[model samples]
Target: MSTDPASTDPASTDLVSTDPASTEPAPADRARGFEAKPGAIGSPPQHYGNPLHEQRLLAEGTAVVDLSDRAVLTVTGPDRLSWIDSLTSQAVAKLQPGESAETLLLDPAGRLEYAVRLLDDGVSTWLLLEATEGAALHTWLDRMRFMLRVEVADRSAEFATIGTLGSPSLAPAAPNGIALHWRDPWSAVVTGGHQYSTAQRHPSADWTYSELLIDRAALPEAAALPAAGTLALEALRIAAWRPRRATEVDERTIPHELDWLRSAVHLSKGCYRGQETVAKVHNLGHPPRRLVLLHLDGSEGVLPVHGDIVLAGDKEVGSITSAALHYELGPIALAVVKRSVDPALDLVVTAGDPAIQIAAAQEVIVPPDAGAEANVPRLPRLGAVRR
Candidate 1:
């Protein structure tokens, strides 16, 4: 059967027991089917009761999400800024204290390894990620520390995260002190980045949510906001054309394919693990794939699951990564399609044992022609004569 239309847990995630090394404790009573999360750790319920209403609360900036299942780490010491700057896609050496920026960890091939939500509060730079990535990310950063003064520690137990739309001040500070908030930079192009999505108004241009680093002691209070779940947040994100770490990224994923450079990449940034690939794809070659929003048909009451093969007739061109029933847009999804797929072709989502396939119209996010050519010279052929 299709996921419970009434069910808010669209991801249908499973619970991941807390590891002994994890600072997190066992999940609370309200947490059950929420096991299907970005990091696989059990989180609070998809919604206290109503999902649509809860989605409203989250979108209107009146709710908060329990991000404890996600992880938080801190980078401390003097070399933090410069060291990080030398390794990521963003310019962080001059990051102002308390300001928020995002960065991506890519392989030398420019394929995304991880993306971080960052905030530097003078004392320490906080890195927030899905629970699944915490250990590996921490270990990777620690190894890269080398002789630097930076220190990496898992802060999940000491600090939890709460996500809300709009300004970081949507809620009051925790009893201990004001929580550090990392504002999302998706609304516009960052200083040294460029946008590949040609839409006059990018969907994420309306994104204003931030993840708050709060005292874990405030879990109850933070999760208290109308009891919305990841489903609610995911719907809004999908509608906004936002690309997430888990669903959108694959082993071959790069920032350009999803138009992520609008905020997460800096074209002029110093060298990092994947700088060459980033520059190469942007300047010399086009991304192998492009991102698109699929306005799925929900009349059958079936929503395509992630990994559902997308076809333009019989040939598989892509697959759906994220799908949701938005409050305003109804059922919609984000898919990574072949860069050469005809823009005018009708798309279909193929999934389920019965093989329920639904037709989808393409709302192109990244066009096939997207690439970098910073003053690329159009050299004439040696034997060609001017007419």
Candidate 2:
């Protein structure tokens, strides 16, 4: 807490490497018309051709995304499952092989430290992470391994990640004999998890997103397998109201702010680093902010970028964390706003050097008093005069 985390620690890791070689060759990025994402930690694609069409192809499950910018790590040895369950915000001890789960490691204050996608193939447990977090996470985990039977390894150099719309038809065991793909559990409330979102059905209920683990030697061929860039994946993510550590978490962020409990947190789980803060917030206090999906006015044909200020009239109420042009929904974004901001209010996202503002309509994803247990009391109207 001595140094300012907002500046020193980023919500997601972005690493710029000077190494001449990469898991996937640079020609792969150029072949797909990708422009390097500026200010991003790892070099990922901004887009390839029309992002809208690319999104459509991805939505239809015919496209693959080069996710080398993301990192993969493995934890093995006898105590792997119990060791992870003791430290994270998920109940993972009984996670069967081929099952997938998400977990978060938080600071004592409940601010997220690392968000991991967990999968165990009987022999090893894999953690999918952002490149920006790879080295730091590995170092931190290594330091915390005092007498634990778990062994950690940074597998990013050995394996690359691939994101796809639907589960690939690869056999339970890959032809190469590696059981590597992790099907996202965002499609439903994962076991031992709770949903804070009161929406009748989550927009992401149908999100069949899966991240496949492939060896570095196979990345070039995988990259050439009918590819789309990160832009396509980003658009669909926003449209589905999904939360990602790279885009949504800030220094002050808690799982409640983004309704991440749907897949990432377990309410009654055993103690962890930030259990006190989590329980206190869920039972007595409220998250300071709420997440919302915004339908942006695309008449100007300008889409706002991440970190743009969101204003309600003259006052700044929130900031857009992610924005995109969906294949069907046109321009849309996800923003986290103050809990006090009226859910019915119309907001504008201010963007660009010229300062163009896009009108936005709020779609309530997380309400003002959002919490795991739904027992909100009805307050009597204070100013109502009775006859």
State each model's CA lDDT, in order.
0.76, 0.75
C-alpha TM-score for every candidate: 0.87, 0.85
Put down candidate 2 lDDT per residue, 242-299, tens digits, no spaces: 8888878889999989888788888888999998888888877788999999887665
- Evaluated against the true structure, the overall lDDT of model 2 is 0.75
Stretches of candidate 2 exceeding 4 Å from the true structure: 1-42, 169-178, 372-387
Q: What is the per-residue lDDT of model 1 for residues 1-387, given as tens digits with 9 covering 90 to 100?
A: 222233333333221111112333433444433223333345544445555666788888877766667788889899998988898999999888778999999988889999998888777888889878989999999889889999999876676677788553435333334348788998888999988877887777668888876655445555334556666788888888888888888899999999999889989878899999999999988999999998766655666767889999899999988887776666778899999998878798986668888778788899999995665888899999989
